[model samples]
Target: MAVASLIPPAPATGEPQSGCYMAATSDCGGRLSREHYISRGLIDGPELRVRGMPWQREEVARFSPDNLVARILCRRHNSAMSPLDAHAIRFFLSVEAGLKHAQRRSLSRKSRFYMTSGDGLELWAMKTLASLYSSGIEFMTPEHRFRDFEPPMERIVAELSSPNPCSIMTLSLPLMQDAHEEQIGRRAVSIGPIVDDETGELSGLLVRMHGIALVFNIDLPDKDALPETEIARPDMIDLIGMDRTSRIFLSRAKRRPEAWIVQIRLSHPRKDPPAGRSDRGCNRQPLRK
Candidate 1:
């Protein structure tokens, strides 16, 4: 379940102030345009009054564009990945905002209850799936964050890197265990017969994109009722990977404020998109840190 907002809060006066562009020069060696830090879509009509503050408060230092280091990316580069960048930026903004406004007590209870479940394996699966949806992953860029790869590129790498041979198997096993413990008051095995230590190591499996780690864990099933294999299976990979879906659900969640995006885009002209394609596409990515 996702919180209402995605973008985080604004920076306090003392926090480090920097632009998203890594190189702020406007030389002819080619220039890069800064993307908006926050998407206008995420902003409420009245929010135009809050200048310079892209996020709410409570956002981590890393997610702030003031602290982000932008790099020069060409037009060809930008167009090829525009959809993902736009979506990611939006997603980042929404998530941060939600965290800042979320009921602190409710969040604490959810964390505590989930933590007590002895099913480390399930926890691992949840973290993996969650990473893909995490705000950090949505706000990433190739030149500045990923360097050689785009945000989704890294997600692909991370998922493929899981040590477990079967992605579905890797995700399902733990989920069954977690659902059992959470829903049914059954105490799962910790070491011997109750738990499968071998599966515990799978928890370490992660899909890291940009600077954030996308992790997942499974929910245990009811002991008397074993897990339903169909739901736990990875049947939605194809749909989730689509450009449109990623942009809507994943990207919008991490968008930065318009001011921030403008600052980053214009910081370096060398990073501008190619001659022909300037604005197009509607895909998105996850953005949170």
Candidate 2:
């Protein structure tokens, strides 16, 4: 689709459009600028760009409301708060193609950011891996899974991929809020494993990511109070205390991965049996047991 066709006709000079868009919220401040759901930079980024153009425009155009969607925001919100929105939009674009790219890289580089080899973690990661796995929710994907952890990944992904549920326009705050509430009780309420080095055993709990649990330490108070010692199994990660400055480390094997599959790409050179062949897989097919 022509880039111009993707962009909505410019609101005639100053005439504002209806605020019916639910993704838009009323800003008491002033007129909002036309924000590209996907960052213009990302549209022209290195990994995704080809010949100075995004190959995914065709895919993104499908989601673009008139080539671009406009939401009313005050200058503050648009410039300040909108960074999150901008980042999220880019992530959505990346994951569509990046997921495959990330997976290929994992096979070689091995990322610790959103992967685990333990059986218990397979189910958790499969369920929560899609959401931003970093301690803080910075990234987002179109497949924002882990909204609820009670259901299995297959069930949830199947539901999400359905045409009815996949439309971005159909999503609203109330719906998202409702889904979040439902998952509160069922969200992964435990830390799977903790792999730590000399910088004190990094202890973090697994919260839902996309639809998986990414184990990262929470930066809370009293980090200095915990004993700086090493532990064996990740199960012992829980033993560590939570405190301020409880640094959360997101370890990614390859900074530039080729696909998005979340599983430990064993880096240990000792290939006794093989890599990606962990004994602690789960009964679920998503977990690869």
Candidate 3:
């Protein structure tokens, strides 16, 4: 494949519908601001690398965290939603910290532990989806691209501004890998639209990078029989709460990984593991025969 240098965002579209793309009833009184398309604070590094974008065209693009921003949110709305970014950062960092601790300690290569809130992380993914569409950028890849991506803008605004934002969303771990079965860049994150295959419409969004991968299913009426993901997974991420800032634990391990497999299998439907069993994986895969 080829590597491309990221060009800057096209000049503003000069459209009348400016100000804040994320505002609904709440007024957009605050100054218009550039929202980091990929939340900057979540980078945890001086720079970030992005891949699989329309402009990059199957090429990897490097960016200083600040350079990857888009002017989409107002000061007030942006500030109000700052918590969303924090939540994503927490979830991502927890995964990072857990892995680091395990590596430093020379613990089992299979697993490590960490904590985060599911609801907030979901919102962050939604917010990221909003950013991607609102910026008017589309995936140029034929299969993954959305040329007529009609985003659910109203739902996005309502969910983001709501005091307890929770709407159509499902979380999953995508085992991101190349044809070579090698992990994509794990040091950074990428946000993109998920288009429905049959309808060719925008479905939801995928927020993934490094060891931390999450999918937000926004378009489906219900998360049933989600298409199998050809991505990577962390060993185990057990989410207990959906709408509140509850502490969730993710004790991950390197499972029997293969290229393009959605490794986080929804496990033991509602039933706990056998009492004495040491496993506590909410996202555990069923044992293979």
Candidate 4:
């Protein structure tokens, strides 16, 4: 199985040369500004960084609030999306609060968590997808030929902004046990394709931060065909908080013989032991059957 790189290279230093990614218009001209690749409100604390496929073997870099930015949107267009940013922040903060509450109580049973937003969450997802796609195009080089691998920006913008947007799924699980030192409270967005056993494919945009994951699937075919798991539906805002049983289920599901697989880490590591141990944050290897 061959895998393609969906992650974009770091931004280069230069004047804004690209058009607005969201509106896809050149009318904005020399007014483009640096836009945060991920919303700032969702991240907390100082050591903000991400690591995984494409980012592997790289030093655990630190990202100031302005680090993960691109000159894609004009000030006017960027300001227009503030409401969506607020919505996404609200959704993420709520999830974080719930996770903290669970940790404090050491809850061992299933509990319900709900968040309400009027299409803001969808818009936020759309904005993220557009930003990532635009950033990839701007930073493309001969060595990295990603033009054919990525989805069309026009098509993505159209579908995401439409009344009936593509399917967006959200799930909450325990903080990944093997999480990198700088990943706590940090947010990262990754894009790729998921190919199932039947050769069916779905373009996936994964946005994860603070123990919550949001997956947006472009042009998903049949929900029935997907593996029977608790994937939060596009219309459902209530989530099943992660617990022991669900954790076990997630661990097993990822190892299933037939599954929908993407080249990304979807499972969290087992909970860590008390601090001060050498292997405290080390990922617990999966048990062999």
Winning candidate number (lDDT): 3
Q: Give RMSD to native, each candidate.
A: 21.5, 18.9, 11.0, 12.3
- Tens digit of lDDT per residue, candidate 4, span 1-289? 1111111222422333356665543223347788876777765666455533243356344566577678888675576556667766766666555445333445455443444462456556666767766776432323343333455567655554343444243232223333222333334433333323244333555555553455555554655533443232332222222232111111111132332211112223334321112331122222110
For model 2, residues 3-32, the per-residue Cα lDDT tens digits are 011112233223333431211222223454
What is the Å distance of residue 67 in model 4 from its true position?
A: 0.7
TM-score of each: 0.23, 0.26, 0.69, 0.56
Using TM-score as the yardstick, the better of models 1 and 4 is 4
> Model 4 off-target regions past 4 Å?
1-18, 23-30, 53-60, 105-114, 137-148, 159-202, 230-289
Backbone clash total for model 3 is 10
Better of 1 and 2 by TM-score: 2
Arranged by lDDT, best first: 3, 4, 2, 1
lDDT score at residue 91, model 4, on the 0-100 scale: 68
Report how far residue 33 has shifted in candidate 2, in Å: 1.9
Model 2 residue 20 CA deviation (Å) reads 9.4
Question: In candidate 3, where is summed lDDT lowest over 10 consecutive residues?
Answer: 1-10
Task: Please report, in order, the local distance difference test score of every candidate based on alpha carbons.
Answer: 0.24, 0.25, 0.54, 0.44
Against the true structure, candidate 3 has what lDDT? 0.54
Query: What does the lDDT come to for candidate 2?
Result: 0.25
Per candidate, the number of residue pairs that clash is: 109, 38, 10, 1
Error of 3 at 36 (Å): 0.5
Candidate 3 stretches with Cα past 4 Å from truth are 1-17, 104-112, 174-181, 227-289
